[model samples]
Target chain A: MPTVELRFAALNGHVRTARMIATAVSRCAGVPAGAADEIKLAVTEACARAVRVNRRHAPQSPVHVALTETPDSFTITVADRGQSGDEVAPGPDGGLVTASTLLDLEPDSAAPPWWSEPAEEESEADGGFPPGLGLALIEGLVDEVQISRGADGVGTIVAMTWHTGPAVAPSDSIL
Target chain B: MDLSLTTRQEGNHTVVVVGGEIDVYTAPKLREQLIDLVSGGSYHLVVDMEGVEFLDSTGLGVLVGGLKRVRAHDGSLHLVCTQERILKIFRITGLTKVFPIHSSVEDALAAHE
Candidate 1:
């Protein structure tokens, strides 16, 4: 099983390239074409999170992505150089984040008629930009998700793994 | 530019045709377009995403923002998306309930009538 590591500037523009490369690697690793879109979307979400984390904390560090192919799964690890002390980050213990936990995205908060109320502060932070759905979407797309601190205890690492099989139906629950 | 945006008017509905990838890098363009349309008085929005090849949370956020903007004026944001890959995002984020998703631009336009 070969592994490929990519380092790109912590910029949103590079997130697409990262995802494209990840999708290409996933295909080469025996992931079905039907699952390519899931890989693409998952990589995009992970890299975008890294980009934002880097921008606010480690502007000079590049976002790191490691795509690895194993006998049973294809895994992508998106790591950021940003420091800890974040509000939304998982615990320092780097606990495994279950799909149910991230599902607290509280879809209803973004629902109509009421999204404009309690979600106003969230919208204001981005100057009216909608709240992000990265992790929740990732959970839906990938087979397994793990969030933890980097080995050097520096930044966050989001590792998403998808089983190498025929294909996972879009309607299939990844949870 | 990973995203392309084009706007057309159809029977009182503003059909925004979006193509290419809608990720963090390109979602802002769509957001700006939606904001301009809402503030400029085009409320009944029908976003045609049939040509979209990719979308992520940023894109989803932009759509949510657009919906909020329009709803401010008692307007509606109907999405025209047929791609299963893309639709999965809406369903996962539970946006399918928040937005009236149609299969085609004509269907969205007709529903807006």
Candidate 2:
């Protein structure tokens, strides 16, 4: 099937766009409204994080979003051009922790303040903020979420899949 | 998100009509409105949630906080929750017991009498 693709500069104001994308995906997949919202939230978080990283690095790069729907499932990919410079080391820091917490990951653990945390060495990492909550949310809301660090180490790709065709329970236990 | 507020001198009541999503992004707006109402000495607040599409924890926090604030002024806050999805969130959070929820705005508005 033909995929849906949209590219826009990553910014807080565009977060709502993710919702629109998710709605399309859900409609195509025949998923529930709540599930559709969850998918939208996850995509928005991931896209926002990518945009944040891009702003910190390139400062002017735009993020791209692609939604592909098949007879059995739907997939979304959020990608941004990676940052270039003195690679900042990654670790259990504030931003990543914040994202994780928002995504309801990390169990009962709270991340220590970033200032007090030790920084690890940086690898050939792409541009993106820490708070891995986007990852967690993608994982929670979908059947699968995959990350692709571009071979050139110049971009990051986040892909999520809804395999059950989007029929989500209307009312969850937690409401 | 949209919010509309109106007060009437019906025996004893100050009603606030809220229409829109009550999520993390919109809760602060509601909080500000509630603060102004209470600070202006308008009590007996009634919140009409009939038009609300969603209500999350942040939204719940504002309601709880508003309830506490109004009660401190020797006043009360009533809610009109007609949306099943919104009500489910309140019920799951056990807020159905904390706030007096009615079926419609007219029913809640008439509560002052």
Candidate 3:
């Protein structure tokens, strides 16, 4: 397996750079061209999520992204130094998430058009999008996704995997 | 490219022409503009994103926010986007059922006309 590591400050500006890198690295790793946009969008979402938490809790910490390529697939791991919560499980092998949760992402169209905290609705803080939206998008973009604790068991690690095979359209989630 | 927002009027709809990528960083800017547009009393909106090269969840959040704001006034917010890449996000998030999406600004402006 070959891997490329990128460590940058948790800033919104770097998210686009990370997306571009994911695209280039995917092509080099034999990921299909059809999946390039999905990879780019997924990488941006993961990095943006990392940047968001890091800015809130660990302003000095950096977002760690490891892009790995194997004969079977390519994996993008985005880790943040912010405090990890119940949202994370054990190690990747010990606990994994069911991407099926993505299917219910927008079940109630009658609900709020965007996600928001009932308590914070009056606070005007970023208008409260669902914390799971990012993960939902990543799961939709990749072949497999795992949300686990970081190496030191302190922060969160989101590992998104994409196979170097026939393209899987993100729209398939609608099917 | 960075985000560039330009607003124009068409009939009763306010068309916001969005170009470039709308990710986390730029999404805030878009949100502010949308809020201002609604605050300025323009309820019906048509967001033209034909030039948007990329859109992430954050951008979607802003669009949703805009929708809710307009809907509060019993108005509508229509989206003008034809790109498969951009439409894929809406499909994956199941937002296609929430907002009316049109392929052209003309169609969006003429949505309820």
Candidate 4:
């Protein structure tokens, strides 16, 4: 179980890289291809959410993605600097909540979308949640999603976990 | 990924079997192909996805777009999804509700009547 750290802007290329990392993790962990894709989508959404939140402080800040695999589970963490209201608050539960909603799991009823469309006046206050359905999709696919804030308001950490199940060898072909 | 679109007459329906990943980068190709089928007065489109192993949001958008175009042309679009992964995506996005899906190409053809 080695860890891979990837730092990049929340760009399209990193989305593909997140997928590749998921495939690699699944290959190494002996998971099914579909499961791997689900993991990849969840992690990619989390990273994108982090970048969206970071836009308030450092719009161009490079988001950091860490993929770590253990014997029993694989964890992908997306981190970026931003402070919501509580400096000592845990990682963005709202983000994880969005991810869970995508997975069809119930998060806090009051939680809003992770990323919202930029509003005319609110754009200066903070990029309020962008109205989209991505977070809900991520939540539906991932098993356990958690959010934790750093001690010094350095960043928010969104972690997604996929547990090892009955090993399904990758087939030679998808179809 | 290689996508080949061919029209085969199954009684009164035209079946177009697509073979490849229908994603964002490749969806435009699918859009073009579907547009040709519709604009050329070719209706009764049945997409055979036996060879499609993967699909993403962009791909789904293209399919939705195709559905809209086909509807406007007074035609219908059907799907032949045999691949589990692809089917799963359809089901997750509730696309199975939007399009008619059959177990196989033969089933799709038979159901058209």
Clashing pairs in 2: A31-A166, A95-A131, A96-A130, A96-A131, A99-A133
lDDT of each: 0.76, 0.60, 0.78, 0.62
State the lDDT of candidate 1 residue by residue for B18-111, as single tens digits.
9998888888888889888987999899999989988877787778778777877888889988778788887776667678999988888787
Residue A172 miss distance in model 2 (angstroms): 12
Q: Could you tell which candidate, 1 or 4, scores higher by DockQ?
A: 1
Better of 1 and 3 by DockQ: 1
Tell me the tens digit of each residue's lDDT in model 2 across B5-93: 44454446666677765544455678778778888887788887777665544466577677767877777889987766667555543
TM-score, prediction 2: 0.53
List candidate 4 stretches off by more than 4 Å. Answer: A8-14, A30-34, A40-64, A78-131, A147-158, A165-175, B1-12
Instruction: Encode model 4's per-residue lDDT on A84-113: one tens digit a residue.
Output: 432222225544334224423243535542
Candidate 4 docking quality: incorrect, acceptable, medium or high: incorrect
- All candidates: TM-score of chain A: 0.74, 0.66, 0.75, 0.63
Residues B45-105, model 3: lDDT tens digits? 9999999998998888788788778877777889998888899888877777767899998
True contacts kept of each: 0.39, 0.00, 0.33, 0.00
Better of 1 and 2 by DockQ: 1
Interface root mean square deviation per prediction: 5.0, 12.4, 5.3, 8.8
Best by TM-score: 3
Candidate 1 regions exceeding 4 Å error are A85-114, A118-132, A165-175
- Poorest stretch of ten by lDDT in candidate 2 chain A: A119-128
Off by over 4 Å in 2: A1-12, A32-70, A75-175, B1-10, B23-25, B92-94, B109-113
Full ranking by TM-score: 3, 1, 4, 2
Runs in model 3 with CA error above 4 Å?
A86-127, A165-175
